[model samples]
Every structure is written in C-alpha cells, then in structure tokens.
Target: MPQDCERTPVVRDNGRHQWEKDRARAPRTVRATTGATERDTGLHPPDLVFHAEYRELPAPCPLAEAFGVPAGTLLLERSYRTRYGPESAPFALVTSYLVRGMIAANPDLLDATNEPWPGGTQSQLHTVGIELDRVEERLTARAPTPAEARDLDLPSGAPVIQLRKTSYDIDDRVVNIADVTLPADRTELLFTTRLERW
Candidate 1:
C-alpha cells in the first residue's frame, strides 16, 4: 500500500450503486458474486478472484449491543476476501453477521453452499419475509493490527477505516450487520448528501 494510492468507494448508503453497476456487466463468474465490483469500480480487474467461508462466532460486543441481544448470542458469520487476481492482494476484508435465530426460518440462509446468492443478503432475507427499510453505517479509524495488516496487505504504520453497517427491517429490528476493513492507504471514504434548499 502506498500513501498516494487511488481511492475506492466500496459502500454507498444511497444504494450499493457502485456494486450494482459493476455486477450488471462483469465477466467471468467466480466463487463470489462481486467479481464485477473489481472491474466496475476500477479497483481490480474483470477476472477477480474471491473466496468465502462461514463461521459461527460469538457476536461481537457491539453487535450484541446493537441488536439488543444477550451477550453470548451466537451469530452466523460469512467472511469474504476478493483480489484483482490470484496473485494480488485482497481489495478488502468483509465479514457479515446475522442472528442465527432470526434467519433460522430459512435454512438456505445458513448454508455456506448457497452463498453468493444471486442477489445477495437483502434478497436472501426476502425469502423469509424480512424487508430492509433502512441502512446505517458508523465509521471509525485505527492503526491496523498485525493480523489485519497481513490480511489486507497493508504497509507498516498504515491505518485502516472500519465501517459497521447495520441493516434494519420495516419493523425497526436489525436484520444484518456487516463489518468492513478498508486499508487507508488504498481506500477512500466518501459520503454524498443531497439537501434541498431551505
């Protein structure tokens, strides 16, 4: 990672606009569905390589607090890492969590084999009658831990931007939470607000 690297906007509260545009025209179908994201965002390549895994980890303290669930709540977690190519460093590290009990109604949602579901989580939750009415993202910055640096290929002394995105349903209950790790050297965070004239 260099100090003057190009910035990539991986998340947009307005609508996953960057992802949608990329997925609409990406080539080479790979393990995960965001293959087009690399090319479309000009971050990676048309033939991006990616992998995903599922882990049942204890919910992070913040996650437990956000969902109003007990401290020991078990969370269904999906981890994904994508690279421009087999030999390239990952674009970012993403891990998403959902309350096991909340999604237990749809067994398919728990199975790793069913991942990269055609339309992603919002669509998958729809199968179980959950409708996302809003998304909120809280961001923070910190120096990368030794482990994070290795995973994201960060240079020494480089910091990282952490994003905690919470998805809420029509009933106002949180349905999904995602933690994204972006290397500061090669990433940029942008927020666009459209305000009407007073």
Candidate 2:
C-alpha cells in the first residue's frame, strides 16, 4: 500500500448511482462499480486492476432461503478483487451470487469474461429485463480469519467490516446478494438520509 493511501469512504447516501449509465464515457478497463467510486479516495481508475472468478454451484442453505429458492438451486458465484497497482493488497474481497435460472436468459451473464460489465450488475440485469427496486445492506464487524488477514494485509488483531448487500427487482424478487469484506483500517462507511418537510 502506498504511504499516501487514504481510507476508502463508501457513501451509502449515493443511492443507485452505480446503476446509472454514462453514455459519453470512453471504454476503459474499469467500469462504474466500486473501482469508479474509489476515485473519491484519490485512486485513479487506470491504476486499478480488477479480477473476477465465476462458477456455478448449488446455493447454500442461507442463500437459498434469502433467494426464496429450494436448496441445491444452481447459482452463479462471482468472486472479485480490485487491487491498486501491482504491489498493493486488494481494497476488499467481494463474493456475489445470482440465481442461474433468473439470469440465464442472457448468455453473457453466465460468463465471467464479459465482466467489468460496462454498467455493472444492474446493466446486466437490464439485458434480462429485470429492473432494480431497492437495495438493503447490513453491516457487522469481526476479527479477520487468518486467510482474510493475509489477503488484506491487515495488522495483527485488526478487525474487518462485513457487509451483506441484497438487491431486489421491480417485482420485489431478490435479484442478487453480495458479501463484502472490507479492511477496517482502510475502509469507511458514510450514510446520509434526507427528511421531507412536514
């Protein structure tokens, strides 16, 4: 990590801006996801590298319950890591799941190579005709596992923030679920809510 590295502040108040499209932007290695948001922390998109691993597997019990699907339902599992430059540790570890049957309508959604998908997951869902309604996120903190500590290069005894994000579609169906592990030392969460006048 660079000595000048700043904590990555995740602004929850931004709402669904990641799902919005920017037509005038040029094609680049980074897309409008977490990587794009890192710019707010002084990280340049060109210096970030994203890696994704995709697989199809049976949904675990908890995931099945969340998706309202039977156990053993096939799901597309995506593991993501975005590192700043070549020598630094990943900003965070993200594992996202989507029901295979629901997204199978679009063949490209089944492939990981198509990722860093221009407008992120929302755009991919759009191709399958699913529109997002809202997203819910739950946060917790815990000591990192040995592997997590090694991957995120955390100091001894440092804790990590776990975020579970669930996305629902227009029909109120759970469309996606993601588990994100952020290094507490380098991650910040900000949330803002507006109150309507009485």
Candidate 3:
C-alpha cells in the first residue's frame, strides 16, 4: 500500500482536470538525473522492497496436517516479559499465545488448554489456548496420546510460556499495539492468529 501522502489535483489548460498519481506510489520507482557528462549517470536507484515480519517469530513455516497448522505459519514461539533478576529487561507482549503443532501431535497427549492463562496478576502473560476444528480431547483436557506430552518434557502439558517480549525495534512492517486484543477479548484472536499454523 501507498503509505505516503495523498495525491494532488491537477488543472489543465483544456478546462477539465483530474488527480495525478504520485510517483511514490508507483510499485517500481525510477529517477531521472542530469550530470555534467552524458556518461556521468551511473547505477540506477536500488529498489526498496518492503515486506511484513512478525516479532521475534521465525517466518511462519507450515507444519503437517496432523497438527492442523497451515503452511507458512510460524510455529516456534518464544516471548519473554522480563529477565528473572532485572526490571530493565523488556516486558513481553507474546506471553500466552496458542501452543505449537509439535505439542498437538503426540500420541500420548493429555487434555490441554493452549493459553488458559491463570486469571489474575499481570506478573506473567497467560495466553489462552482454544481448540481448532473441534480437535478431540478428553474430559481431563489431555490429548488422547499420552506420549505427546513426554518428549520435550515441558511440565508435560504445562510449559512455562516462553513469550516474545518488548520491542523497541520498528521496521517497515510494524503493527500498532492498539491492534492487539486482550485475553478476555479472544474471540477476535481466533481469526487472526490461531486457526492458521506456522
């Protein structure tokens, strides 16, 4: 999209006028410059390619169908709110996001909640997890497979969330914090974050 200023109106001698498109919005940019010698003009301007990137998450890469994750969806999730001893460490915004597909595939999986973050105190980010496509689960909320919870060994189903945290860095692809939804307002998060997998 054209992030630059709006276009200006043009008035022609013929009487009728129309808005002229700004060069900035042109997908392919070009410049014409003059030099002392005909050969003085050198390399053309380098194209500025802009694309979006999520914070600290690996580019979303697709997993398998068994995991119910879509291709190009980032799976390795890690967010941190603070260093154990210091307040200066950046606070994390990515704390209780949904669990990765690897966690969902194990045969020994038990009843699990992705981000059922503990209710009170902002001390930790408690991202809640919601099941996708009516994924099967037991009354205890464990995946039918018990071994799925064994390998990585992160408290079995309850892994102390490794969240993506505070970022002072804003590159071309930046998201406004106003756009992020709170845990209580998760119905919106489903369409944007969880349904598709990395």
Candidate 4:
C-alpha cells in the first residue's frame, strides 16, 4: 500500500465531492520503513486483515495479575486475529485490555463496532485526555495448546512466541496491556534503545 498519504479519487454526490478511505488495502499495526513484518527477515507483505471483538469475562484472569488489579475487576477485553490471504492459518492472535473505569468518560471507547480505529489505541486514549509515555513488552516462548495449534495450522513441535505489552501514561500509570501470540517460524521481534554518553 502507498504509505505517504496517497489519496483516493473523490466520488461525487449531489454535486458534492466525498472522500473515502481505501478499504482494499491491508490494515497496518505500526509504522515501518519497509513492511511491518520484515524488520528481521525482509519477508514480503502478506495479504492480511485484522479481525477484532470484545470479550466478556466472568472474573479477573491473568491480565488482572499482570496489572496488579483486584480479582473480578471489570476490564474491556479486545481480541484480534490476523489472517493471510486464502490461508486457513492466522499470522497472529492478539488481545488487549483496558480498565473500563478509566475510559468510561468516552462511551465510544466501550463499543466494539467502533474498532479498527483510524489511529489505534493512542488516538482512542487521546479522546479521553490521556497521553502515553512509554511501552514495555515481555517475551516468552512455549508450545501451543491443541486449539492454538489447530487455529494456527502449525506443524507438530512448532513453538509460539508470546508477548505481554504494557503501556504507561505520562503519570506513569498503566493504561493498556496486550497479549500477543506469534507463529515462531514466521515472526521476529526487534528492540532498540538509545543511551546517553557520559
């Protein structure tokens, strides 16, 4: 997809020009110089679409433990699956959590129908006057559950890389947490940090 502000032709209605987003293009997760998935391997971009939905939980789960929240705390859980073109396997599975109380001021944030938000979570938080300061990701690898293996179409013995991403605001309060599952054979993780010289 053209990255640098490629404009689609305007359509006219009642002699008024209307701008429409190009929906055929695959959705992107983050900014990348090349392709989003090619940071380490220069892999070609796959035809992909991201599907997301809100999950209802009866009680606090692992996410609550990671966030140090009390059990049974109500959280907004959003689950995502990215699938490649004409393929039964998914590129990855990702789920994100946010405290419902933190964003209750913006009713739009609570609805799944408003998802695939134009600017992602940062934009969503901006609506509520929150600014993100930094993000941290913890990583681990493990065997997939039988259901995961079936969903990902992994070969026997294939591992999956799991990531727990935490986002903090300028006040240093946790704003968001995300769990990601990546097919070990096709995914890569890269981290860069800058340091000041003495």
Better model by lDDT: candidate 2 vs candidate 3: 2
Off by over 4 Å in 2: 1-36, 39-42
Which tens-of-lDDT digit does each residue in 110-192 have in candidate 2? Answer: 98898767667777787888888777889999999999999988877889999998989889999999998988887767666
Give the range of the ten consecutive residues with the poorest summed lDDT in model 1.
Answer: 19-28
Candidate 3 vs candidate 4: the lDDT winner is 4
Give the TM-score comparing model 4 with the true structure, all chains together.
0.72
Measured with C-alpha atoms, the lDDT of residue 73 in candidate 1 is 95
Cα deviation of 197, candidate 1, in Å: 6.3
* TM-score for each predicted model, relative to the true structure: 0.77, 0.85, 0.17, 0.72
- Which candidate number has the best lDDT? 2
What TM-score would candidate 2 get against the native? 0.85
lDDT of each candidate versus the true structure: 0.71, 0.78, 0.21, 0.64
Clash count, candidate 3 = 36
For TM-score, the strongest prediction is 2
Write the residue-wise lDDT of candidate 3 on 97-121 in tens digits.
Answer: 2224433444222122221112211
lDDT of 1 by residue, 1-198 (tens): 442454344443344633443343334263244433543355544456667799787876888998889877989999977765533467678899999989889998888887556556766677688777777888899998898998877777989989888988889999889898887776656567768999
The local lDDT score (0 to 100) that residue 102 gets in candidate 2 is: 96
All candidates: CA RMSD (Å): 4.7, 3.6, 23.5, 11.7
